[model samples]
Target: MNRIFATSICVILATSAAAAEVELSFYGGVQSAPSSDVSIRDDDSIPDGDFSIAWEGRSLEAPPYYGIRATKWRSPEFGYGLDFTHNKVYPENDELPAGYDVLEFTDGLNTLTVNAYRRWSSAFGEVSPYIGGGVGVSVPYVEVANSDSETFSYQLTGPAATWIAGASYPINDQWSVFGEYKGTFSSNTADLDTGGTLETDIVTNAVNLGLSFNF
Candidate 1:
């Protein structure tokens, strides 16, 4: 039993050490802004619960999106990856007047994902296309951006689903360019911590361009 346990521990440590030696900074991608139907409200103050106090999709809009990824390829046809991304925009309640919904980073969403993929080769390894899926953690801050006023924003987290498909064309043995489609589905509700709740639905369809390197 002791010998078997030692063998297992050695195998795990060897795998971890191999991963640590790989070039970690090797991929970057850019995509269009994500789309979500997210809104939050205060139930205590607004009895009607109409457009007068809700921020619609417009609040989640931001400029083009970019992300960094760390991936490991165990073989020529398979690999695992993790992604971190940020979309800088204010989450507002568009239903209210112009000035009432100007909260920044504190109300926006942050996405962290982990996934695995299998690459298919064709044309004598000249082309590689991949399909993958993973789960994501969608976190929304609970603090408001209003300086003069006080409104707290909190979120109840839920499962986020992701799917991706892409193709890469090698420029050389060390570099390649690729394009892909990615989508996410996450449904959650934000609590104002006052008297209102925001039904936040995040469903984003995006296309992306990526540059990859093997070092």
Candidate 2:
């Protein structure tokens, strides 16, 4: 994870140095996930089950929800960038299956994406509205504990995607504050310690407030 993050930062810095209108932004906010179906399969050491889990975001807790982005605009109204989000989910305790004691991705359901964005000038007085969408991959820190086995590791699960709608207010020529609604979808199929697999598809929605530096 450290190596991946470091490499991403290097790429962003290199891209920013060569870009005409580049912006770096950081955000923190509340996020939530609706209930989703979960499937657990194992040939030995655990029971197999298919059930629904009510996911809790607990965004304000330790390890929180946050995001960072770097954008390079080709024109005043259009741009593309890299966006990374640290998202998490916890299943309701009562929803756990017969053999499982813990199942959650509290550290991160992390996503790194390449997004395309479009902005409109002064749609609400001094505020400019923008929208974006992207496709990426999911790297989640899986935490699963059962009666007979446990697994805790980061795994590349599958494809992930995001869409955002937001507006910004310029604080100065080189700084701005923004708020946005962002949604992400991820499909995960992860390996278990018991030589089986767990699969689920998750959708997360977030409301974020952020600051940006433009050059």
Candidate 3:
């Protein structure tokens, strides 16, 4: 009877310790303050009486985003993670007007990014501060409702970069919450065969609210 009681107590302690071995976390909210800027070109040379012309500028606003991250600690202070995120921004108008030309544009900005990052925990309660960057791809779609006489469309997919800084806190043994600010950068260029080519650059600034899990 004594041996049986000792074994039962040992099993309970082992189970409790094992439960702390792994942690899962989740978080969600809103990301405010988003800004974007782009440059567009139709030609570089004058056709008849005109000269070279181009338009480029920047804009700022508050934008929102959501994401999820899973981290598994190989040790206490350091761990590896997988992160996924989504962002959506709409254009103010379907048509963009220039000095002498008008462009019919449809659709906004939509993207999903995935990357791997390293996490670090500090003295703050169950919370930790982390900084990491990864490379991914950006897919942007645009529709031209009226291209002179015919409608035209194209897609942009290329290399992009993601950098984040945020804090995360544990709610329990298996769950936690996180918030971060992320920036994405990319560009696209094309040749039209007529005169000069067209080049478009897009930059997205976003605030991210989401959750983190450890196992």
Top lDDT: which candidate number?
2
lDDT of 3 by residue, 1-215 (tens): 12222333354344334654433333334422223343334443312222222222112223224444444465665554444333434433322433323221112233334444556666675678877676655444333222332223334445666677787777776567777777656554433333333344556565556654444
Error of 2 at 96 (Å): 1.9
Return the TM-score for candidate 2, rounded to 2 decimals: 0.94
The deviation in Å at residue 64 for candidate 2 is: 0.7
lDDT rank order = 2, 1, 3
Q: Using lDDT as the measure, name the better of candidate 1 and candidate 3.
A: 1
Query: Which residue segments of model 3 deviate by more than 4 Å?
Result: 1-65, 68-74, 77-82, 92-95, 99-116, 147-156, 189-198
Better of 1 and 2 by TM-score: 2
Q: Local error of candidate 1 at 104, Å? A: 8.1
lDDT tens digits, residue span 46-141, model 2: 678898889989999988898889999888789999998889999865467667788898889888889999998656788899999999999888
> 21-134 in candidate 1: lDDT tens per residue?
232322333333333444556534422232322222332334334444556777777777665444233333332334344543333344556777788867446778888778
- N/CA/C clash count, model 2: 0
Query: How many residue pairs collide in each prediction?
Result: 9, 0, 11
Candidate 1 accuracy as lDDT: 0.53
Model 2 steric clash pairs: none
The lowest-lDDT stretch of 10 consecutive residues in candidate 1 is 47-56
List TM-score per model, in order: 0.63, 0.94, 0.56
